[model samples]
Target: MVELNVLVADLRAESAEIDALVGGLSADDWATPTPAAGWTVAHQVAHLAWTDRQALLAINDEAAFRAELAAITVPPERMDELVDAAAAEGAAQPPAELLAGWRRGRDDLAEILERAPDDTKLPWYGPPMSAASMVTARLMETWAHGYDIADALGVLREPTARLRHVAHIAVRTRDFAYLVRGEQPPAEQFRVELTGPDGEVWTWGPADADQRVTGPALDLCLLATQRINRADTALVTAGPDADAWLDIAQAFAGPPGDGRDAGSRERERRTPA
Candidate 1:
């Protein structure tokens, strides 16, 4: 098992950075098109805020929390108008307001984490989550939504070093593989090696195990989080479960997202060989 304290600290730091990067963005950049189909940069940010609000409810009020989920699962026909409204509401506020609220939300989350005693049962996507899993999910969201905004703005955002939380999530999503294929990992360990930003690298599990995945952290995170596809991306997976695992990698809460369309690869070609 991974260390909970280290994972949470990494999440908090990355979340702070994501807040700073987005805070400095131009208005037009925030409204640009993202890898998320039909979602603008504002929509991506709003989704992060919206997800945080849900996680807050999970830790605070269970009844209120479960009831509130319909809002996310149900696809609204008026998504464009709703996103426009959220952006208008968020953008209209002064930069200080956005920063203050974002900071408050992150702080509140961190506080909840601090209060957990490692034995605490937290609400999670599949089954109850340890406090560490919850924090990892938070970090994954920070990296993911940050990228949507960064890519849309035509600037680079590097969360490669901050991706152990996400890489952890990906490796643990083995059950999703059972859903895709009928079998699961054969009672053996797997290894994951990711090359992070600025020469930093992250490796998880044991090498020379039943399964191993190695790649640039950016591409691995993108593939594991379902933000990109295996066919076009540069990630390499070796072992019995690799191909099946890659077919349906999910690292977040809620229903499986369609992600990038299969036949029509958009960002992969432009991502360099």
Candidate 2:
């Protein structure tokens, strides 16, 4: 398990970075659509705020969380519709109000996570997760949504060591990815090797594992977030399960995501434009 303090620190930094990104945006900017199809910047921030509130509920009142979960009427096939409705309702507020709401929710979550017991299991939308895993999930969602916001606003966020947290979750969730797809996970663990932002090498799985993935940490994080299509990344996979895992790698807990379309640039290269 990752040190909870380190994970919380990273989550704080990630939250701060996102705050800075949206802190000065105009109403028009907040309304701008991001790379996520049909989701504007406000929608992304609103979703984060809503989830933070949900996390708070789960921590403070598990019975309430269970009740909330049980009230869901949308079937699995319409999950995106459920998300769209939630985002729209949440984003209906003024831009300043939205930002403030998100900030308050984020701070509340950070404070709770800081004091949570290391081994405590918290019920989430998916399976129960440890406090550290909960914080990491928050970090991954923040970073992923932050990426969408940055891209929409034409800002380039420098890759940070924080990506290691996202990468770690991505690797840890490999089995979840398989489970969500209703496929049996490989009984064997495949090696994951990534070059971190500072050029430090991060390795998971056994050193002598026959299956392996090698790539830049940023690419791995993006792939895990589904921000980039697996077909477009520079990652190299050298095993049967490794290749399949890359195609469906999702760190977020949910139904299998609709992965990104291979960008127009990739499509153009394959055709004469």
Winning model by lDDT = 2
List the pairs of residues colliding in candidate 1.
none
TM for candidate 1 is 0.76
lDDT to native, each model? 0.68, 0.88
Residue 79 CA displacement from its true place in model 1, Å: 13
Question: For model 2, how does the per-residue alpha-carbon lDDT over 22-75 read when each residue is reduced to its tens digit?
Answer: 999899999999988889999999999988998999999999999988988887
Off by over 4 Å in 2: 264-273
Give the clash count for each candidate: 0, 0
**Position 156, candidate 1: lDDT:** 60
Clashing pairs in model 2, backbone N/Cα/C closer than 3 A? none
Q: After superposition, how far is residue 33 of candidate 1 from its true place, in Å?
A: 2.0
TM-score of each model, paired residue for residue: 0.76, 0.94
